[model samples]
Target: MSKHSVVIFVSQRNSLRSILAQACLAHLGSGRFLALSCGWPGMLADAIHPAAIGALNSASMPIPNHRPRDWNDLARPSAARAEFVITLDETTSSFQPRWPGQPDSALWAFPDVAAAGDPEKVAHLAIQMLYALRRRLELFVSLPLQGTDRAAIRSDLRDLAHMR
Candidate 1:
């Protein structure tokens, strides 16, 4: 199997979606893939998003004290180049991004309704989006390199979700 590393960029580290993806990818496909998350140029290292951390913990995937990082640190010599970069934002330009190795990238718009705010509203907004992402992403990352069958991949995704 080919090793794939993805650089996931977000506006801030203190949030539901970005950390959720990082933890989920790391937990689900740890050996097969390398996953890291960053933010725009000056985003600070801060506490993990409360709602997000809770969401992940409830799902048995808690990730704590995630530091916000930038492309400079990432592009440093020792870091591996990301083969794919995915930006998660509801608006296209809400965050700054630079794709390494001219990698394939997509601006996936997702609701940040779980930002620092009231618990009920955030849960209603953020966790809902997380479920949606979990469904689509299972199918996405399951793609094989050559002659991969779409129907089989879908079945696999369904089974994987059930297992989760």
Candidate 2:
């Protein structure tokens, strides 16, 4: 059987943190999980943030196509529903959608690194987000997912999301 899938959400522009988490998990999960990302149809950006691209380059991970998509784009009739839905910001966490199975979800609130004025700060934040998501995803992919430990798994994910 195929492994469970994860979807990451970010509000507003789908250019930074959410995209990073999606790429990071896809790189680290190694087919253990499928990762997808989307954002609200608010203030869409024309492309992914340059700093995000830089961070991915620094990590030697290939950047996904610099496309920003909304949640509705992926919620079509035949799309594979997510088993876990991770919201990368506060705004997205509050805007709940009627996911088919009401998948397990969590909100990991990270700062808006792409909006930071300085390029240096933007790069720093990108790196920080990349590593943090990597750690959380590592934990997630290691869980005894087939065992009866749903509560513990949720708790761990919640704790990871709240980390500073």
What TM-score fits each model?
0.73, 0.90
Report the lDDT tens digits of candidate 2 across residue range 51-131.
Answer: 889999999877877598887776665667767778887866666566665677788888788888899999988998899
For every model shown, the clashing-pair count is: 0, 0
Show pairs that collide, candidate 2.
Answer: none
Please report the candidate that would top lDDT against the real structure.
2
Q: Global lDDT of each model?
A: 0.58, 0.77
Runs of candidate 2 with Cα error greater than 4 angstroms are none
Model 2 lDDT at residue 55: 92
For model 2, state the Cα shift of residue 58 in Å: 0.2
Please name the candidate that would achieve the greatest TM-score relative to the true structure.
2
**lDDT, model 2, position 116:** 89
